[model samples]
Every structure is written in structure tokens, then in C-alpha cells.
Target: MAAAQNTPGQHRGMDWCGFAGFRASKAPMQAYAAELGATMQLQVQMPRRQPAPADIVEEYTYTRHFVAIDDPVRLLEILPGLPADKNHTYEIILKDKPCKLCVDFDGTDGLPACFASKQDFTSRVQDVLTDIFLTEFGVQLPAESFVWVFTDYPVKFRAHLVEHHIMPDGRILCLPQHNPTHATRRRQALLQQAGAGHA
Candidate 1:
């Protein structure tokens, strides 16, 4: 049997939004960090019941990603009392201009875990970052450069269509008709055709 697809509300009361599939130039990180000094920070929390083994500790440094922890202070208090052989989790915080973004490694590689209260999950941090780079640092990125995905479990993503498509005959087609309404119509037509074929 096929596994159930993950969607929002599957986990009951938890929804996450973040960006993926966007590649930014290395210049942004360098420029931001130069201006802000340590634009990113690594937060490590040692295990509670037992200390992390040497290999796990080494892995933390190598992977450069950490599990999300609620209270770092509480974890620190227990850290001093536990043995030195348990595993710890890690979290990376990126200090983007005007917003402190938390990077969650699960579901997608380095998805910024921005809650819906501030904005919908469809919002892309990459767009904001791209704007900052262009306005502040004079760096320009292509349109629709960031893809945002929001979900409750497993994981699914939605991205904008590229500006142009290349045909098999080597013809290049500009995609001005790539809006949501066109996509919905295309999907409905495909479904209707499939249903008729099945009949």
C-alpha cells in the first residue's frame, strides 16, 4: 500500500512554513555577516539523562545542524549533572536583517521555521533576503527565486514556474501564463480527461 501523503492539520494543531529550492549567492551571507558580525549562531544542548558520546559530539560539529530545543537554560542546568556519554541536539539561528530566523533541518534542508502567526507559510524568507541584498547591498536576484513550502507532517512544497520553458524542438517559450488560475484550469482539465478515460 502507498503511504499516506502528509499535509497540514495531520499532526493536530501544528503547522510550519519555510523556504526551499532557492539558491542565493554566497555574497549575501558574507555581506550580512560582515555588517552584523556573526549573522549565524549555533546553539547546542547536551542530553538530559546522559552525556552524548564523543562521536555524537563530533557529528554535531560536522553536520552543523541541531535539533530544536525549547529552553536552552533548562537544558544547560541538567547538562552539568549528567554523565558524559549521551547525545545532544543542535539548532542554528540566522540573524537576518530585522528578523531572527530559526533553521529547522527536518522535512527539508535548512527550512526556516517561521510560524503562521507572523505570516502565512507560503511566504518566502528568500524573497525578503533577496530584497535586503538588492536594497542594502546592491545585489539583484532573479524573480521567483525562492520556493516556500508549508505543512504539518511529512513534507510538501509549492514553487513558482520558471520564467521560460525550453521545448523539445529547441524552441524557448516565455511563460507569462503561469499564474495560479492557469495552473488550476490545467489541473482541472487533466482530471476531467482522466475521469473520462476511466469511464
Candidate 2:
């Protein structure tokens, strides 16, 4: 059987409220909680975790015509402390006229000791974030965006949608949210179209 998922308090007081509760004199988890809060505030533009798996299944149907954001570094940063062997991936796709970001982390090599430790995880995550910001957005090292982190087992991936920037003609600045498979299909289609028109 899989190792037990950490309890809400397993991280030692880092609960869902985004604050670490104090049991006594120790406040070890407080620093991490503050860092996490700041990270969420700067990176995740939207608040709250994505719909649960059960809720997603009950409410939505997976479709094509979506976009995919394949940023391995971003994935690493968002899920700080995951084992190196545990590879994580996030897919933002088009579903129901909105973009949804889905995250999953698997044992690429093999699962190491549950994250190694939170501090190490957080530092590594920050490094990943730095790289992602510089390379993708071509902005500074720590540019902020609308990304959120969820608390899923193995890892969590979160997203906030771009809702307000809609046009009267029904045009969307962001693409739809679908699975990575669909995104791959879309990419191939785009490449094929581009190739066909070559002189």
C-alpha cells in the first residue's frame, strides 16, 4: 500500500488556513508558512485549489481545442520539496471555455524519502521559480503571475483563470484548458499547417 498521506497537521501546524498554528513555544513551521503565503501571493494570481478530482469528473467533460503550458521548472517550483526522483508535470488546458491547470507528480526514477525535508524543498522550488520567470516571460528573475499551488498527494498543482479580460465579441486572451494529450495534438496540427504553407 502507498505510504500514508501527511495529515493536515503533519507538516507540524501548516494547515489549510495558510498559517501555522502554535502548540507551545516552538514556531518552526511559521517561517515556512510565511514564505509559502508570500509565494502564493506573488505567483498564483488566482486563489484556491482547483476542483477536486471527484468534482471535476462530475461537473466537466474533457475536450480538445485547449492549450498546454509545459514548464518543467515551473512545475518543480510550484511543488517544492518533492523528491528529485519524483518528476512533476502541470498541464493547463481548455475545458468548457476556460483554462484549467492540472498537476501530477510521479516517481520518475523512484520515490525517495517523502520530500527529504521541507526547507530543502522550499529552496529548490524557489530556484525553479527563478529560472522559469527569467526564461519564459522574459521578465526579471521573480516576475509574478496568476499561478496557484494545490495540496495534492505526491504533489499539488493550482491555477487561477483569466476571466475579466473578455471581449464583447467573445474573444479570450487565454486558451481553453484540456489534457496534455490534446495540447500535443494541437501543437502537431499547428506545425503541420505551418509546414504545408512553406515556399
Candidate 3:
């Protein structure tokens, strides 16, 4: 998954670089860090959780690693090889600036209990990447600026910008344009109303 060489006008003026993955593994993280000529450090946090058994409480812990790169260009060069998993979380922050990019994979199709069926996972990821770019760099790039080069996942292109709608009060609204279930429910309601009007 080595990143392709940057062509003219491609990702120009971009000082930030990061990758998104669904449940990506640690091996890939280390690999990416090595490629970027950086060191990786792992941090583990333990939290307690209480379930139906009120008397019993359980503690769980998760580990996260931090990789700092001096040059973002090095990070950008290895974008294609980054892990793309839904179960794990990964991020890299620039040491010089307050710029960072993170990928959230909790609700994606990777979690079967949460997502029984595969939704438009790639499009959602693209929207999130776009939003992050906007937030970090304050630049709005065309949807095509981001591309999913992994062949393991279904090929997807951006249908519309779901997270780009910014309200006047400074709140962001994510209105998915191609939600099948929402569209179905709305269609059903419309048909019912039309039937009632005729009766």
C-alpha cells in the first residue's frame, strides 16, 4: 500500500498528513512509524465498567500508541500502506503544530453488532477525512482529494458531503445524503399520507 507519487496540483499546499483504517493492527502502525523515520510509544489506560450484575464491576483497558513525525511529507508518503481496520484506533500528531487527524471506526461496518449490514462505510470515512482537513487546515478540498486505494474494501466515491454543512451558530450537522433506511421510512410516510388524502 505504498502511496503513489504526488502529481502536479495533487495535494498541493498540504502540510498535514495522516491515514485512516478500520481496526488497524499494531504491526502496521510500527511499520508506518518506521517508514516515516519516527519512533512509536504505546500507552495503556484501564477503565472500569459495571454491567447488569450490580454487585460486580469489571475493569477493562486499551492501549494506544503515539508516533511523532518531524516532517509531514514523510507521513504523506506512506499513506497507502497504513492499516484500514474498524476495530482499532490510530492517529499521528505533528510535533511542530497543533494539527492532528484521527480516524473513528466504532460505528462502521466492521462492528457487526453495531452495523448488521454494510452501510456506505467508505463514503462516511471520506466525509470524516474531509471534515478533519477543514478543521485542521481550514481548507475545503473537493471530495476527490481523498481516495481509498485499498482493494480489500468495496470501491466507493463520494456522493455528497455529509459533514460539510456548518450552521450559523458554529455547529456541524452530518446529514447523510444516501441513507437507505431513512429514505425508506420517509417514502413509507409519504405513501401513507397520500393514501389518507385519497380516502
Candidate 4:
């Protein structure tokens, strides 16, 4: 599920991240939370485990896009940590519209693991997703569709849309704008003109 994140110049707090609750008290989980807490500092929140009944356990409440990650390295990289066998879930933000994409790659050889390099992983995944969306959803995209696309997954940091190329979000930007060849555009225009003639 996606939650509203704190935009720049906005209030910096759990309230801003729309962060909910979960508990992780194990040594690794605790260490991960500590590191994240220290790293995020004032930009985000990492509260300690709240009081609860002994029988009733809780999970660590994460204030980020992705969730249920055990590795600090992967989490910090804004990647998921699931077995290669399992399908990974990603939130694709196309033209400012978010959609869930669950995909399972065939054959593990050279296949991307869940928690790989944040930017590289996202770039590669989005490339394939663009094809899928464009073909399945149709050539006419939403009004908000832009030449470039991105996601809200927080890597070393969270990347965002802004003027001057793009604001740094810790992940290196590698996504190229969708530029159709001139011939392709001409053919599309001809097709439109022909259809209009029929109408």
C-alpha cells in the first residue's frame, strides 16, 4: 500500500510520512531500526517499541514506501528483500498515477534480486513496466503522463520530480524520457488523419 510522503518544505514528522505501526525487537531488526533512525534524523521518525501486552507482539513501524524488509543494507538502498523465487511488488508512478505491479522473473540466472542497486533496479524495472503499461493500457496515456516516470521508493534517499533535471534522492537518475522517432510520430498522425476522414 502507498502512503502520502512528506514533500520538501513540508512538516517533517511521522504525521507527514503517513507512517503506521509495526514492531521488530530482534537484534538485527533493532540494529536496522537504529541505523535508519540515526540516518533519517530529523527528516523522519523512528520511535521505540511502545508498551504492549507480553502475549501481544508488534512489528516495527516503518515510515517509508517499501515495508517488511529485514536487511539494513537493502532497506537503506530502497529495495525489497524477498527470495528470488517469490514475485516482487512495486508501485509504479506513471504520470503521477500510482499502480501496483507484481512480476516474477523466470530463471534466476542474471535475474535481478529484490534488494539490488536501488537506481539500477528501478530503472530496469520501469523500462519493462512502461512497455507493459503502454501496450495494455493503450497508446493514449493519461493527461498527467509525462516524458519521464519515477517511483516513491526511498533508496539511499528518496528521489522526486523537480525542475533542473530532477532533485537528488540518493539514487542516481538513469531513466530517459520517452521520445518517439519522427517516422513513428508521422505514421501515428497519418493514422489519426485517416480515422478522422472516415468519421
- What's the TM-score of each model vs. the native? 0.19, 0.25, 0.23, 0.22
Tens-digit lDDT string for candidate 2 (1-199): 1122212222222222222111211232334336544322111111224443553331122111111123545434445543343333434344554553222322222222433543433344445544544587453433233233333232322112122233346653343545567654543342233231111
- The global C-alpha lDDT for each of the candidates, from Candidate 1 onward, is 0.32, 0.32, 0.36, 0.32
In candidate 2, residue 22 scores what lDDT? 15
Q: How many backbone collisions does model 3 have?
A: 9
Q: State candidate 4's TM-score.
A: 0.22
Best by TM-score: 2
What's the C-alpha lDDT at position 9 in model 1? 24
* Tens digit of per-residue lDDT, candidate 4, span 103-192: 222211332244254455435434444454468654322323322323222121222221111223543222233233532453333223
| Steric clashes per prediction | 6, 11, 9, 7
After best superposition, candidate 2 residue 29: deviation in angstroms? 35
How big is the positional error of residue 56 in model 4, measured in Å on the Cα after superposition?
19
Q: Find the number of clashing residue pairs for candidate 2.
A: 11
Return model 1's CA RMSD, one decimal. Answer: 19.8
Count: clashes, candidate 4: 7
Writing each residue's lDDT as its tens digit, candidate 3 over 59-167 gives 1112233344556565555444434441223343343333222222221222223222334444444555556557976767466544333212222211221223344
